[model samples]
Target: MAPSNQLEVPQKSRVTVVGSGNWGSVAAKLIAFNTLHINSFHDEVRMWVFEETLPSGENLSDVINRTNENVKYLPGIKLPKNVVADPDIEHAVRDANMLVFVTPHQFMEGICKRLVGKIREDAVAISLIKGMEVKREGPCMISSLISEILGISCCVLMGANIANEIAVEKFSEATVGYRENKEIAEKWVQLFNTPYFMVSAVQDVEGVELCGTLKNVVALAAGFVDGLEMGNNTKAAIMRIGLREMKALSKLLFPSVKDNTFFESCGVADLITTCLGGRNRRCADAFARNGGKRSFDELEAEMLQGQKLQGVSTAKEVYEVLSHRGWLELFPLFTTVHEICSGRLAPSAIVEYTEHSARLPLLESPVHLN
Candidate 1:
């Protein structure tokens, strides 16, 4: 069927972005471009906001920077002034066509819960998060949890693409998963599709979400390998095992998604970047570089004393959840977790473990199912 005027043209498309971190800022900017590219807005890109953050890193920013009031993060990007930075929830979601969530994984559910009271039923919600909620039985996958709470099926965007690369308009590609309806899913793919930013559609939202979340775990493992002075061979070995562990864990959580290859764009692509970011890896690297170096607690305390430790608590929660399940055979990277937990296994030992566990098969295709 041809796209009717009603479907082809948005009735009234106003997009609101929920977070203002690096990914959030980049995504909000792109969505502004997407709306403009579709010619869906006649008078500027519908209102957008960076949604401010509080001092403790909570997203409730009380002090607004008037100097940095414009929505475009980079100068000369030429964002339409219509895309305003609104901090109020009611003002942001009111009469909007879509809401995009770009906050940290742990914060997504609470934010989604808050939106339930505000957003209209017809409006579509998009999740750009890449981690699972560390929970038992249900709502483990991020999308499912949001969809269930919102009482509407939510779509997810995941891929090997990076924020910095995309912000500069470099070549990038991504996969959009919509479990609600194929037509709805394709609408987003077509809406944001551009020559440089290739977008594909997939019905396996579970696979996409699980892959997105699990790869970060593998990244921590890779960082551990890096901390240990592991060679390229060792790094490659960790990558292979990491993908397998992702496959096994994803299989257990989202059985609906049968594709087990975690080496795809969303899996391995995201994995490499997370390792290179060097946050969690720094923890291991510090331990590896010095002998009888500061204990984990001492290192964490010392690091927190100087710079912020963002994801240590979240990573610890992930480790604890995995341990509670007693699902060791399912997660070979849990070997890395065990070493981190046991206090006996040094950073170098993580490299040896990677070498020992490197026999898993490589993924056949870099891309997963459609």
Candidate 2:
């Protein structure tokens, strides 16, 4: 053995992506590329796959390892050869010092519980999941939940990201939201930034994450307009009203939320893109076209293969928070979106409720912090 006085080399950071859906796979590709080129990180990336058997009776993880493609979720795009797929969640994350959480919001609580004692104590996390969980006390952001449960600092990444487009190296921009550590945020930006995918970091975590969560609700309203075949003027009006409500609700919930955060790629740009072309909009369009008879569940399975729709569920979660706090009237566009989504109102009600409710003043009452 070497002498005790001899200096030991520092360990390079290892990364594990905890989910392997469409977005998760793309995130792995981006991180894998950066790690291979950057000296500070390990070149190999581990991706946790929720094993499913294909019709051909092959395990999803096996197929991914053999073909270097997620044929079930994201077909045709080859993940980097260094992005190894692991069927075991604990095994996937055990050795990594950086964890990327990209699973559905609803499943996050359970996932966090499973990871409590499994992850390295010094590991840092970033959430790409764009939703929230409503606990008995109040609404908890996914990053907050990860931090609280796993005893680690968690940041978030959100923007006008359409995963499939990013997978093809199309140009896009994303924002990294951090609570305090700017250095950690920059490291995350570096891991994700590329010539085609530009990334920037901001100090407002809640604002950025809330922007990502609330935009899906707005996208549903936009979809209703599209399904109704409304003209560009009407669609633009809907988008404007939705953005105002998003800002109002975010500020009212987290009084510390920055107004300028609404100008970032995670804010107005994400709202616009999700409204125009995201899966939430596409599925909501189908829900409206079917006269709201077909549930979002049926439409999601039919349209998305296996991907989850954030808008319908996010609308429900936001409705719970609004109704609990008696702020529904203040957020007319938000209220109407959830009402229409849950079958309490017809899809056509989006136009009437939003138009009438936009006239009311918002956040006039005391802000309730949860």
Candidate 3:
């Protein structure tokens, strides 16, 4: 049936990316292409730049707007014309109906606080961030923080997506985790899907998100093994143990999370990609090379340029949760990663301190979650 004249016209959706890092820039590139092709979405894509000066003393935002490239973070790749770089977060997201939050997870709370009562009432958000916030009460996922602070329904996108490879249009896959709204989730799928970038939607938000977050801790362990020059079999063993821990931790935290979600792009695929190529693995390799003499903060600054490794902080945060709940003894790998990162144990101990040495007596038993 045709709508009457009194019926309101649907408002076109405007897109804004509230970050300017490597992944953030790639995310803008992907969304810019989609918004222009989809009639329901506005042509302009606003990306919020934290506003830094380049080494040559040029304004980063101005350079991106003039050159159509994120000259500092994601150099050498051309961004779409519609992807406008804005320095002001408020102005960038002013008229935006679809906000993509991709900043480092640590800054999200402050960012959300600034967006309270400022964003569109109907705005929906999706987090491309892979880290989680651990409060004294418990852990808070980025999606939950956004929903609580902005009063918006938020979903999460995660997988084995590396920023540089995705920017060059390599084949990759991602998973969108939604709470309930299938329609909203499909809209996100449309906004992100590309020929080279495949996207899928799943109903298990916590499962997909934990897969993304917890994998960082595991990646750190993988890095330690690499630094130790352990053979392929040893690394494979670490990976297998890490995968079991990841699934067990997820199930213990959120029982509703499906077992099969671990088989999706956000699960095993992400774990493999991150372990092999992610910054955490790279830095962990370096940390091991130095014999843990230099602190992670110092190494991060020297090794990663300005980019932060999510695994180091994530391992610490996960440790906090495990300790608070008296579950540290149950999670041997996680506990060891934190201890090793904090310089308590040598890199080689990644193998020595197995579940056998921990307080758990069922180390030889089959993988089962209590």
Candidate 4:
């Protein structure tokens, strides 16, 4: 028989989102919907807003708290009433046993450092950011960095999810990449899945993440193809080559990575969408249209407003990794993307390099088929 004096657990399971940007807002909205319907979760989804002033002279957090929307980042969308926005990151993460991190990859390390000793001991995290940090040791995935810094298990969610489309409740699918815990992964699926947004879990975190990371570099190449007014055949060729390089790099980095994971929403789906419609592609298109006269930094400022592009940085980082490991010759597409981005080669050189590399057997190696 159970003891009558046993302590009862709180009916409300707390959740917090560690970002309030475009994707962050959508994640909060999705989690807010689930928290209301899923009895195990707390109704209020706390979203940490990195405080900033909008074009108007208003506090962003106050506006979000009052209007129940992230008007600046995700304008024209109504967030649920239960989604609370706070500027205090520490306060935001204090009680949250489940944390969703969707901030820009550049700011993630600082954010993780700040959260030290503040979160619950049993907290689990999910990283939606796509990119990595290249140190002297090597490229560290955002999820891995989070796990190492925060002393928590971190899962990743990646897909062909465009924030604007998801914000409007358009149908989409995402993959949750976890290490070993199926039950934990399912909880994440429950938090994110909806009629419009389907979520599935897989055990290959590195494959899903590398697909998300490297696809941006490919998108840059695709954007060049678009800027050059290249036809569909050229763009298709670039994508095919990019996908092959993506698989090779992922397997090279982590032998445990599964080839089938590349078929999931996080892999090919992400690569396709990013090349066709992502911000990186758009900016790269602009860079190419201008004949590479202006730098990507200048275009990103003029075009993206305040948002950052991940591809350009990812290219340099990946190139650094390849160079350090003496593996640059093994990845022609990857190396060429960086060289082109740095103006060492013309935008047209994207095609030229890939074509030249293809004719040669430089990238050949004994590898598993994807």
Candidate 5:
């Protein structure tokens, strides 16, 4: 349960959003949904807006006053109006009490660096993106990356759930991990928790971040097996093994988080979503169907168009780094998938690796196979 007495929930607060992409847009919408009291404090409180775009490409803009009826992605629901989109990075962080990052993981470091001087020292920083650094960093997770760039500790918002599913106010669960400061963590949980959005608070930043980050790897493997047209028996075996791998890595990397064993929320829950709804799987499917001719970027863009999910370029990056380092003990399926993606091994090799690495007995079929 979230502690109400500890969190400082302001009647109205300014939140600066860093990105306006699919995830960014959903995050901004959530900010508006959670801060519905801003109008009550009209003169006293205004939700100031700050939004940023990629520098090299043409500047991007967000659709404001977009209702669920108007927006195709949004379900039939009403949206709040206080949240405004600003293109200026400096102006966005200026005087804002909360900062939320929804950009891709690769772009977050640079974006945070740009706002380092401008961000209010007291403002809470939160990142919704999940992935590891492209470059070598020993034991550094997404939270550490944010702390390094911002020069301050920040909380992470992550889970197995997807944005489109959340945007529609579907019933789902997520975990908010923060430092030992239980007060700060609960505040965030309360801020985001609505009728349909149930949030759990964790003192373990590493565990929470790892669950969010590593699930992509497992999901990629799941996608590979699924794309191979492996039956549910094979898919189920992969999922169970994937959970064990996640638990082992979690124990090694983040011992503080109680119960590293993956459950529906962290391990099993997120893995299935990513493998089935995940964009990485779609990308893998494209490669499998096309005979691996197109470039990574082309396959990724095509997957996004069809599935409307973020591409897993960063996930593939992490897979490569870990596999090269010989840290393949925990996530063997991921390692296998990585090999297939890199052209070092063929698709059939994935099945062979899983059979070789798995230690537990294969699951018995619950239904008769045709």
Candidate 6:
């Protein structure tokens, strides 16, 4: 009662989403809804748009602001009114203390370059993008790239998150992976958790992120099985084998990865959903049906509207890493997916390596398949 002059007001965190594609729009909707109800955040959510001219000749950001919907990427879904779309990348994130990155992996390096020295010094980032950048040195995870380029600590959120279903309020779960800060991880959990969307946090950043990245390669294999007219049993075998390789490769690259992380929503669950019905799987199916005559680029243009496919690109990236390190034989499904995608091997080759992979010993060491 005697400290009336010492009153202090806590600062609320402002959030900006750094991409405006399908998943990005859904993420902004979720964050905007929570910010309005949560006291620790500002109600306004700024979403950065890679501006495009729609078929109606209206600028995407302008239309999003006017209609409260992403008329191009996420049509029919109503974005919250407070979710403002801004075309200027720097301006969208300039004042925000929390950044959510959901862009394609191929474009992230350029985005980070443009954002260098532009974001808040104290800002924290969370990557919802699930792919890696292969460099001459090695593979770089999205979260690591953000942290390295932006000078901020970055975390990752991943799961069996099919954006369209979640946009409609279907129940789903996600896992947030943090480095050393439990408090920061919990904050992300609180921001994304909703009645229909359950969120949890785990300490294995690499494990969670790799699960999300590598599963797309496996999904391509699953799609091959689908296109080849393989029954459910064969698809199940591919998924099981793919999961094994996912766990093996994750631990091989980052020995600190925990085994229990494989049981999380980001692990087996994500692998299952993506392999069954994800864009990668869908595209791979079409690629196989065409006897690999049509390239993935052609199929992508026909399908997916304007959205991007992470699997084919990720498979190539992973293959580069494996080829450079002489570990190609260690991951058969991953290797086959890249070979098939690049037209070196038929799509039917997805199953050719499975029997060999299944026979390999457990990957207790780099020489075994534990």
| Candidate with maximal TM-score | 6
Off by over 4 Å in 4: 1-11, 360-370
Q: On residues 239-322, what C-alpha lDDT tens digit does candidate 4 reach at each position?
A: 988888898888888878888999999999999999998999999889889989999999998998777899999999999999
- Compared to the true structure, candidate 1 yields what TM-score? 0.77
lDDT of each prediction vs. the true structure? 0.61, 0.92, 0.90, 0.91, 0.63, 0.93
* lDDT by residue (tens digit), candidate 1, 49-72: 445444456442322233333323
Model 1, C-alpha of 241: deviation from truth (Å): 0.7
C-alpha TM-scores of all predictions: 0.77, 0.97, 0.95, 0.95, 0.81, 0.97
In model 5, the runs with Cα more than 4 Å from the true position are: 1-12, 38-79, 134-139, 306-312, 320-325, 360-370
lDDT by residue (1-370, candidate 3, tens digit) is: 6757677767889999999899999999999999989998999999999998988889999999999999778889999999999999999999999999999999999999998888988899999999999987799888999998889999999999999999999999999999999999999999999999999999999999999999999898889889889877877777878888888778887878888999999999999999999999989888988888888999889987888889988999999988987788777888899999999998777887753433355433323534
Cα error of candidate 6 at position 194, Å:
0.4
lDDT of 6: 0.93
From the highest TM-score down, the ranking of the candidates is 6, 2, 4, 3, 5, 1
Q: How close is candidate 5 to the true structure, as a TM-score?
A: 0.81
lDDT per residue as tens, model 2, 55-107: 99999999999999999878999999999999999999999999999988888
Report the Cα lDDT for candidate 3: 0.90
In candidate 5, what are the lDDT values of residues 1-370, reduced to their tens digit? 7786897765555666676555566666666676664342222112222333324342323433333221423335444666655666787678776677766677666777787788878777777777767565545666777778777767887876777787787887777878878887876776667777788877777777777777776666666677677877887777777766666656655556556425536556777777677666666666655655565567766556422333355456657556665566545676776667777777666678788769634222212211
Question: How accurate locally is residue 2 in candidate 1, as Cα lDDT from 0 to 100?
Answer: 75
lDDT of each residue in 243-275, candidate 6, tens digit only: 998988888889889999989999999998998
Which candidate leads in lDDT? 6
